[model samples]
Target: MATTKLTLSVDPEVIAKARRISKLRKTSVSAMFSRYIATLEESKQRETPLPPMTKRALALAAGTAPVPENWDYRDELKDILDERYGLK
Candidate 1:
């Protein structure tokens, strides 16, 4: 791909730090900025899909579990709270 030069105004201290880091990494400052910009562009794309474990859990929960008849979660939660907190 063709590349275009971009002129940016940055703080002298920030440029100095970037120069030091790039020198230590044995890469040009422009190359470092290119990599950083590429990373930002990649992140702007769609996020990664859910992991395998999460996908499997969701699939198993979707109409696969047997729920007991007349099961009220509110009553169950109240009972649990009463037992734990000694509330009437």
Candidate 2:
């Protein structure tokens, strides 16, 4: 696959943080942005919708929420309830 040069206009602070994180992760800022975009693409392809609370919780989140293929509603509900009620 061929890679292309893409330009983005982000806040300087965000770019600085990305650079710091990329260095720590031993990857380039371009790679980090590419992975982030790829993740957004993948989540966009999922059919499942994000639960209401999760949606609310991630109201500030960018792009679509990802739901795994093996995502279990009942188990997730149980876990959320258990954590909420301290019944775990």
Cα-based lDDT for every prediction: 0.92, 0.91
Top-lDDT candidate index: 1
lDDT of 1 at 58: 90
The number of the candidate with the highest TM-score is 1
Tens-digit per-residue lDDT, 1-85, candidate 1? 6778989999999999999999999998988999998999999785889999999999989987677899999999999999999
Q: All candidates' TM-scores? A: 0.52, 0.52
Model 2 lDDT per residue over 39-88, tens place: 99998898698899899878766566788899999999999999999999
Residue 54 displacement (Å), model 1: 13
Q: Where in model 2 is the C-alpha error above 4 Å?
A: 49-88
What are the C-alpha RMSDs, in order, of all predicted structures? 9.9, 13.6
